[model samples]
Target: MSLAPRIVLVHRTTEYEELVARHGTHGQAAFFLASRGRDIEEVAERSRRTRRALDEIAAGIPLTWRQARVERADLDRFLFAPEDVVVVVGQDGLVANVAKYLAGQPVVGIDTDPGRNPGVLVRHRAADAGALIASAVSRAGAVDELTMVEAVADDTQRLLALNEIYLGAAGHQTVRYRLGRDDDRGAVEPQASSGVLVGTGTGASGWLRSVWQERGGGLVLPGATEERLVWFVREAWPSPVTGTSLVAGHLSVGARLQLTVESDRLIAFGDGMEGDAVELVWGQTVRVGVAGVRLRLVG
Candidate 1:
């Protein structure tokens, strides 16, 4: 007989908890919120709801299965096995954050407040977590294999993104880089732009959508499950040293985007988490392509 699968619960800090941690006390947090005309009771109520949801989900996990709980902030340090079933109980972004850390593990996204926060990723309700967990463990659940984007530097430092990867300067300054692709070798052009955004089909409605809309919607983006990626250059500037012709394009299988850094420093980040990024200096080459792994999101 096979052993029970380990269920890992993932969550994020509540607004009330963050306030208290920053202010050092509940009373101080309340006062700080009041000064900004925000009600502390509302924040407290949200925290209560989150705790209730967490408790209900925990109670539903089978006692026979091994269980573990982790916060989003500590996901990097958390060791996840291939057979683990990850249950994320938070907003949609929490699901995206956890997806990168996983290889092919099944993930169940539980929305704490479904009514207010309708999400594409966090589709399951807290009340249904028990059934979902059981289904996932038995490998009988409906799974959505979502495409992911990956960025690899010259040093072999790789980062996976569920939504998109942003590459540019650390600040709001214009970034200088030589952009090219695997298909077009000698056609590489020097670009000075705000940044470059490499996104997947799952990210079409996110930052990619905004940039696409701004450009008057010329390109047709891929679907959430499509094995393709879209890239857009934000505010590409045309100068004597830089060209803006290669602003946006699509990347299919066997096609990869390459960037040779000409700036003093360029930062690459995934899922809009700028703080957690990889730094690339001058002469470094980074490749963006469709990731080999896909997110097995339980539907």
Candidate 2:
């Protein structure tokens, strides 16, 4: 028998959560914030709005639909079925956060604080959930196929990210590796720097753009739907055995930038989630490129 599509609601803990976590109670949190010359009401108000939106969204789901809620911290442990309609109930970053774990699920982004948060990813209001849910089930929704980046370690471990994948030291310290392509010049030069970042077009709008701006805007960043990849090496120092020639560049679809570990330890992580990462030891090679899977996000 066939299975019905499940509705997966994704959210992240708010600032109010951390406030109460440290202060024990909302009243105590308020007092602590007030003592620091800050108003806790603002934080509480935002948290209230987020919770209200989540409730409204949940209420709109059909009773027959199998639904589940997964927090941002629990995404790593949660398993998503193929027939799942993901509804991200938070800011823009939450959508990007859930994108890595998903294969091709349709993500509906709901924004709690429209004025405070950028609605680039979470572009819809809670009231639109009913129609959006119907559209997604019928495959009639406006879905954007966003490109993603992937890194594969020599040991067969892999990582995916909607924004970017970073390979470097755990502390963001100087990374030692050989940067090059697979053709004639397999591994070009040994580099020691902050690390390397392999990003997609979606990433270009954020961190990649900042790095491009810092480098005088030479790299050609692709669009959100483009099947392209761009790379950048941070603070690559010059030495007798090292070179900075492969500082920044772009990769066409299916092409990969190879990096062999020269340091005792290096970590590969996606979308800034350093805690859940792939570890690479000396002499290990990691190839980063555009992933075949794309994020099917409802616009």
Candidate 3:
């Protein structure tokens, strides 16, 4: 390791920022929200809290060590160092947002609004940043190596997600793809569906659980660090051209879910970040599985 590991502080744009950006000015955004009987102050207050959290985290960094602040929008364009310690300040989703971009760096998740967020990934408060940063840098902290999911395209392109990886249509219409498990090549089923979702145990509490509940426990989900993965075909349409027999299943360790495109084009996105996705066309294939790499989270 380097004599002084760099600290990479990651955060996402706030709702207030998004509103202003969309409406072209804060006054216009406030007017729009006020017209709907919503107070813009609530949104602005959240941004202020986030800003304070950022300042606290930045203050915690030792002057002798190198550091960098990264926004969520620019994660794809940013490069991380091997000896870096990542500190993400935002909601639990932000942790998922940054997890895909990391390798094995230890991450410190700080909750800016613990009361409203009810976060799991972010276990610490902004006020605790200094001590947590010290412990992590000194290798005196305990880290939970959370399992993740990965999707590898035929062309060798790969995408990772801490929560779940989704393969579906870019729009609301159903997508056409052949789905199968790696071990059972003979059971490949072609179907028309909204899309497919392959998720980690960390994702069970969110979108994955909804699917599981809606189907009355069709597939059992793994735990956060479990070496297993689960997949489901959303709203599979039954027709002469498509079948719904292979809708849900689990991927054992090292096993993968195979997808062969039948539509003109389909999209593969991870952790609900549709903006950054892998584009798949007819006849293309991608494999989804529990990723070998894990997220080292320091609590």
Candidate 4:
């Protein structure tokens, strides 16, 4: 008989939990929120709903299948097996957080509150998890392959971002770097900018969309499943030492955008998660490209 596939349920901390963790107590959190004219009960209600959804999903799993529950914060330390099916039971950002850690594993995005939260990534309700789990285990579910972006530093430090990768300074200061494309024949342009944004098709609708809109929609981005990626340089400042001509472009499959850091410190972060990132000092070269692995998202 074939072995039962392992199901990994991923979630995030609720507002109430975050408040309590910050303030050290429920009463202190309530007092702090009240001072800010926020009602603690609203957070409480949201937390209660999330708990109910989690309970329903837990109960729906079959007795024969092995199960594991993990929080978004703990995903870096979590070990995901080849046969594991990941189920993210939170907002769309939670799905992005879990996507980088996975390879070819099928993921089911379950929106805890479909009414309040935009279910762009998390499109399914908790009640449908059982059926989805069965389909995933049997490898019978329709999967949407989402492209991902990767940033590899000269030191071999690497990061995989499901949405986009932001490369810039640690503060709101100017970033100095030389930008060049792999296909460019020895031509590189030094640029001084606020930062650089490299986004995959999955991130086209998020940060990339806002940037594209600000530029008068001149550039048409690829779809979420497309293997192509778009990049933009934020607030590029032109000077004798730097240029702004190479500010935006597209990266096809197997193509890479290279940057040589001239500043004292530059940080590279993926999917807007700054806490989990890599730091590149002066004289380091980082390459941003399309990652080989694709996120297998189940509808």
The list of candidate 4 runs beyond 4 A from truth reads: none
After superposition of all CA atoms, the RMSD between model 1 and the true structure is 1.1
Residue-wise C-alpha lDDT for candidate 1, range 190-275, written one tens digit per residue: 99998999999888978899999999999999998999999999999998989988899999977899999998999999998887
Clashes of each: 0, 0, 0, 0
- Tens-place lDDT per residue, model 3, 1-299, is 44677899999999999999999998999999999999999999999999999998898788999989999999999999888889999999999999998989899999998788767899999899888888888878998889899999999889999989999899848988888888996989889999999998999889899999999996778998888888988999999978999988898778999999999999899898999999999999999998989999996
Clashing pairs in 2: none
Every model's Cα RMSD, please? 1.1, 1.2, 1.5, 1.3
Structural similarity to truth (TM-score) of each candidate: 0.97, 0.97, 0.96, 0.96
After superposition, candidate 2 runs with Cα above 4 Å error: 184-187
lDDT of 4 by residue, 1-299 (tens): 86678989899899899999999998999999999999899998889888998999889998888999999889999999999999998898888888889989999999887788678789899989999989988889898999999999989999998899999997847989999998897879999999999998778878988998898887779888899999999999988888988989999998999999999999999988899989999999999999998999997
What's model 2's TM-score? 0.97
TM-score, candidate number 4: 0.96
Write the residue-wise lDDT of candidate 2 on 27-94 in tens digits.
99999999999999999999999999989988888897788999999999999998899999988888
What local distance difference test score does each model get?
0.92, 0.90, 0.91, 0.90
